[model samples]
Target: MQVNTRSDVGGKAEAMDYTKEAIADPVVERSFRGHKGMVTTAAFSPSMKQLASGAKDGVVMVWNFRPQLRAFRYANSKSSSRSPAGKEAASPVHKVSFSPKGDIVASGGADKAIRLWVPNVVGDCSTLKAHTGAVRDVDFGDGGATLLSASDDKTVKLWDLKKQKFLQTFNGHVNWVRSAKFAPGGAYAASGGDDKTVLVWDMQQKKSVKALKHHTARVNTVAFFPSGNLLAAASDDKSINVWDLRTFELLQHYDVGSVVNEIDVHPTGDFIISAQDDATVKIWDAREGRLFYKLHGHEGKVQTAQFSPHGDFFTTGGGDGQVMVWETKFDRSIASIKKKMAMKEKKAGSNLEEAKPEEVDAKIEEETEAEVEAEVKADAKHEGVGERVQAKKVSISEPAEDAEREVEEAPSSITREPEVNENYTEAAKEEVRPKTAPSASPANPSSSLPSTSVSGEQVMSALGTIVNQMNSLMEVVGRFDMRLETLERRMDALEK
Candidate 1:
């Protein structure tokens, strides 16, 4: 379909150099199955209320995009009648196009005939015949007063629809012409063919203007960007190429990795869809030249894809003989923009000043340290309370003599501290270590002590145990901090 229009030739622009966002997940809204053979081509009406599809069975079907919007549909338009000589009357169809006003559905097929069907009413279709070879593609001009068709005749032809007469034929390709499109004002036309070339023609002059021969194989589809400044083509060479129309210079190349059968640019020039032989439909961001999503419902090679005129949805037909409709999900576009914005903010740029790296590191370190300290203090308080309750119970019930017994009962509690206290008690009993001890000046006048009075050395040793436990907590916090830093770095790298 033609991308450029009278107004909004200036469409949604994106920065091709920017970082790409994550691909979107696919969502199929509807599926229509009736064709007994490969569905070759499909197109959305300008109104988007109906969809027109043509298949190899020589049938054209018009379907309601939405169940609520009722319109006449031709579920099977192929004639079942056979000739007396036992020959099939119907010919394989290759392409279908909707008029600008959504009033007529035009289909071209192997019969070398273009049939115009009034899809909103039950009526006979009218045929317009001129080409001697099978028609491959057809499109309506700006005002729907004219039509363009590419065919196996090795030429692109323009016809006056209002007069129902052939206007002109531009010949250049030595092989079948596959696709044709009109520029913004319909003054110029572009066509791609099996000759591995894309040609731009001045329709008024009836001569070729630019010849793009970069494709290594048959060119399958071609389209002009909305502004008429760029044109894109897809080929069996497994690539899609964009050219600057003004300079006729190659601007971008996308290695699709599979034979591309058909490609269409969105009306806003923001997205493009490629139907590939891998049974996949690839959606790409036009400005960034990035593959945004891959749809995987068709069981056979996907042959045709086109966007709705409003750009909110698209439809695809495949060799499986089914057409699937999918919504683009505008919310995902906003999310992608937000993600790209975040990437820009994080990246170091001359125009965007960033905080000093050292300053950020120091700030994070300080916060982590504070949090660790608070957690350590809370653990110490809880530990002290449990210790005091255990000590009181031991003093009242079993006495200090059974402290070793209590330790044996709860082996999980206080393993090292009890052994240190035992060693100090043994030293006091021997009296050999008394000389290094402090003098007992506090017991000179008023002394209140039980039979077992703990020495000052034991208290110092217990305080050292608490310091050791705090160090262990700090090590645990350090490990956690390192892990968080690693995670943040990975996320930053992906965004860039």
Candidate 2:
């Protein structure tokens, strides 16, 4: 994944140091670091003026979004030397929501309580606690007249916002309900839970209108498309399943590499975004069902992904303790530029190929030697373990008999390699078997080693044990590689 981090300094005035891709990186931006635990959710105000985030710490922060966007805009400019500040550094908030007018903000937390705040006010807040368990999700209904909340108690409750009274409790899910979202029209809301079921409730009737049970694992999140005609679901089954609202029939199915924690459709319904356990937020073309591009940059699982009401930008809240804002950018002439660069590299490669084979081989040898030297230096600095473990884990290439033969031929070299620890070599030596066994006495050469050799039987047992251990180690290694690659890709994206 080659990223072009080169930002253009001579172009548009509104352009800041931030690229649309920068929004995808988890690094590069050091702001919004207050959350002490993994952030579980985030939402942007309808006006795009405020951002709300919630974390495992049972705290949520509602900050001014405009300044952060501007700071990113000026991050690469000569004026970027100035320090940046935020509107609010802390809040006693958990899950947050903005009213239709983007005035009042509502937050739910582990305290089994919900709080509403009037932003920028001296002392204005209303607290409500009706659920018996921590609230997992919250959303405002049509015109902010109603509020929907789901909890670990396995119930979804509708509340009258003005009266601050619980209106109804809908219960059908057999387990803890993890998420709930009001449909675009507020006529309905969808709830998903550990029971691997999604219940669509008709707000007016106060009953489930549909029960979707397609996921093989726990359902994580659900959302209604802009038209309110379709629903997108993310589940522990490691898939995103879209369903039609009119017929209540399953529609498209897309597999993300790991647990899909959250899914949101763009306001325009042209794209969809998924937050996954792999620490990646991926964007997909909704209508065409094609991957647009993967947005990388979260050090931990992406807890939530949402698009702004205007469809110009999207926000992501990550377990890494930060929120990111991504927007669209136009690449006017990237195709022409890449074509020219490709031709230049091709011409240079052809010119170099005309050299003598020995010289070319020597150059190749020199590069290889340089690589080996760097590897040795890196090993001396303690960078050998991770890559080596990853190599052994992935093992895309088969284990080489040549290396085993070389180890057999020069046992001392294997033991002397500076890259391997002394204890490891000693362990290998203890495990190695001699190529040939000692002969019996001349009178009975066939019975030299043992009367009835059990060594072969023992060797087979040891081989089986080793094979089992290797299989277990490979599984562990595969998980590590997936996680590490995900992290690196995210950091690289942030750096870009």
lDDT of each: 0.74, 0.66
Model 2, 1-496: lDDT tens digits are 2333423221111221222333322222224666777877777788777777777655556767556342110000011122246232232234667788877777776667777767553426787779988777888997998899988889999899899999899999989888899998898899999999999999888899999999999998888898999998889999888999999998888877799878888776767888888887777657667665566667888888877777566677777888776663322122345577799999987876566644544554454434444443454346333333212111112234543443244322211123334354454444552334555234554433333334576567656755644554444434434433443343344335
Question: How far off is residue 298 in model 2, in Å?
Answer: 1.5
TM-score of 2: 0.56
Poorest lDDT segment (10 consecutive residues) of candidate 1: 4-13
lDDT agreement of model 2 with the native = 0.66
Clashes of 2: 6
Show pairs that collide, candidate 2. 16-73, 25-494, 26-297, 60-93, 297-490, 440-448
The TM-score values for the models, in the order shown, are 0.62, 0.56
Give the Å shift of residue 111 in candidate 2.
1.5
Instruction: Name the best candidate (by TM-score).
Output: 1
Off by over 4 Å in 2: 1-31, 66-94, 121-123, 330-496
